[model samples]
Target: MADPILSVRDLVTYFRPEEGVVRAVDGASFDLYPGGTLGIVGESGCGKSVTARSILRIVDRPGEVESGEILLRRDDGGIVDLAKIDPRRREMRAIRGGDIGYVFQEPMSSLSAFYTIGNQLMEAVRLHRAVTTKEARQRAVELLQLVGIPRPEQRVDAYSFELSGGLRQRVMIALALAAEPRILIADEPTTALDVTTQAQILDLIRRIQDERRLAVILITHDMGVIAEMADTVAVMYLGKVVESGPVDAIFHAPRHPYTQALLRSIPSVLAEPRSRLATIAGSIPHPYARPEGCPFHPRCARSIAGVCDRTVPVVTKLDERHEVRCVLYGRPAEAAE
Candidate 1:
């Protein structure tokens, strides 16, 4: 079997606050194969953004990656442990934008207000490449065109405030691609845009991924977006990965009750009008008030006898690539008996 481009094993990220510690990412693990797209879906505060930040080792202060191994496949076929690598190391510096690009959720905040869009793109190119200023500017123009920016030369000199939301997002994509990274981590890149713009951005991401053979980590709460873009999906709840599998499996044959509930809640086109959307019974328990047994047991519709409450269920595999950390179907036979 071919090796994955990125593999995360038993990741745990916690935030220490005056209030208390919040386990933003607890024991989350997944793999990203070359040229693959992995979608992470969950509600806000479910650790979707933190998981992305943890992989890049940019967790904010008061938050620390307590444990885990993030293995990155190097060009020489070597595996580099990202967790152990120091933030100041030259290798990590090279890894951030050179190997992995990021498209942030809010284009307005992410882009500098003072700098022109062209200047940002040129700076990105110049940082990663040993090129003359003129050459870098040309590459920047090409990137804008590649991202479907209309009249790239004219938009190049525009400031963040001068561009529309969609145009700003395109510029963000253009900047992310400046280094020609192998992986793109898009953290809810389309959330703020209208429906039409959101579709355009999704289409743009697909085209870029196909063109570059990039590994994409798409983080969003919209299951519809995941169903459209993801080859595989991971469902996170209370910092833990409750279920993960092929998009089809998770969408059609979801094993965990949470996964089922989430899918049911998405408004369907074919369903009868006035049909109420199905909602999970209770809210996600607070980080400090996490339930003792299964964090999800309190809200799970299919809570099993003595399993969801007494013991934390282990992740059990339904097949080679599909697994769920729930008590229903993916539990040990001994426990099942």
Candidate 2:
């Protein structure tokens, strides 16, 4: 396996609201290689988006990365800890859009209403690359064409409101690629799109990854999307990853109770006609009132009565490249003696 271009370990991001601390990302860890896709999946409020934002140091105020190592392998073959850097520093700002490109969930909200697509793309291009206005505009047209937008020459001048949802998404991709960054963090890029458009966007991402060997961090709640696009999968519950492994391992041989429940919940064509889809019993625990022990214990059918409700489960290795945080697989700390 290639050395990880990005590695996160024991990441803990907290939101200190007046009420309490929201542990948005607690002990989340993962690695992304140069040309592979890592899918982070969970229900809404499970911290998938927060994990991505934390990596780029773009978490909104009142929410800060409390502790962790965000290691980034730079172009010069040196390693830097992104978590330690001052996010407002020029170097960190350059790293934000220069080395890593982020495609947000909603194109309509992310793109400015007053600016043309060309203007937005040009801003991205010039910010990273020393290019004149005319050159940046030319690059914008090329980017639109690269992302498979129709009539790149004309659509370059169109505002976000002038385009369809699918087109707006394509423009978002163009803007993310405007800097030619090595890594792309796509947070629910297919949200609100029709199934057809969803497939197209996924395909475009795959094609671009193949062409550029770009590493991708795809954050979504859709397991089907993860199965289709991710090389590896990380199943997050509450704020921590409960299961992680190769996509095949996660889908065919999931170990954690939460992972199993998630896979079972996926609606399938092979299911009995008119049968109800399986659903996880309860909603994720509220961040302020998070349960002790395994965070998923309340909803996990397989949770042990006394053990899972009180003691936190440590990570247990299942096999090479596969791991889970559940007592079902992990030996107790004393048992290791």
Candidate 3:
């Protein structure tokens, strides 16, 4: 495999509230190769979106990347540590749209209600490219079509309220691609769409990735989405990744108890009638109230007697591409003595 286009190592993001610091993203690590789609799957409030926001340096004052490195490999082979770069720096600004694009969860929130879709898209292109308004508008229309929005020329003039949810999402994708970035971060892009629309959006993302060869980081909680689109998947729980491996490995034979619980919770079409889905017994540990040893032990069915309650387990690697942080991986012995 080629060197990763984006590498996140032990990223720790926290939010300072009146009640204490909330560890929104604690020691999350992953690498995404060029043109690879890495899915960060976790339930809501598990910090999937926080991780993405941290990568983009959009964490506000109350939240920050306290530690770790975000190394991005440039086209010229130079390594840029995104953690070190100020978000407002000219270099970082240039990189935001030029090398990395982001499609936020809510198109309505990211999109301007006051501005026309065409204007927004054209603005994104003009910010990155030194093109005339005419050229940028033309490019915006082309992108709208590429993202499957019909009547690109006409739709560009419409407001956010005028378009359907799916169409708005397509516009968001179009805007993200306006700069032709090398990496695209889709942060819950299909959340507002219906099932059929969600599938279409996922397909669009996959097609876009293949056609443009863009490295994609899909931030989603839907296991089905991860199974469908991800080459690699990271299962996050309470801001930390419990298991990360190839989609097939993690899906077929999950090593971590949390991973197993998550898989069991997914409703299956082929499941027996009247069968209740297997669910994790407890709710997610509060960010500030995370358990002493294993954060997930409180809810993990396979948790060990005393070890899981006593100390944090070290992340153990089962293979080059698979790892888990669980007491079941023999961390108990090391922590005990």
> Best candidate, lDDT-wise?
2
lDDT of 1 by residue, 1-337 (tens): 4688999898999999999989999999998888999999998889999989887888888998889999999878989988898866888878888888989899878899989988999999998999999999899899999999989888888898999898899899988889999899999999989999999999999999999999999999999999999998999988888899999999989998889999999998998998888998989888888887688889887887577777777898999989998766666444655
Each model's lDDT? 0.89, 0.92, 0.90
Clash number for candidate 3: 1
Predicted structure with the largest TM-score when compared to the true one: 2
Q: Which stretches in model 3 have alpha-carbon errors above 4 Å?
A: 332-337
Candidate 3 structure, TM-score to reference: 0.97
Candidate 1 vs candidate 2, lDDT winner: 2
Evaluated at residue 296, the lDDT of candidate 2 is 93
The residue ranges of model 1 lying beyond 4 angstroms of the native Cα positions read: 330-337
lDDT per residue (tens digit) for residues 1-337 in model 2: 8789999999999999999899999999999999999999999999999999999999998999999999999988999999999989998989887889999999777899999989999999999999899999999999999999999999999999999999999999888888888999999999878999999999999999999989999999999999999999999988899999999999999999989999999999999999999999989777789998889999989888988887888899999999999988866564354
Question: Per-residue alpha-carbon lDDT of model 3 for 1-337, expressed as tens digits?
Answer: 8999999999999999787999999899999999999999988899999898888888877998888899999999999998888888888888887888999888766788999999999999999999999999899999999999988889989998898888899999999899999999999999978999999999999999999999999999888899999999999988888899999999998999889989999999999999988777978776778787788887877777777888888788999999998878765555767
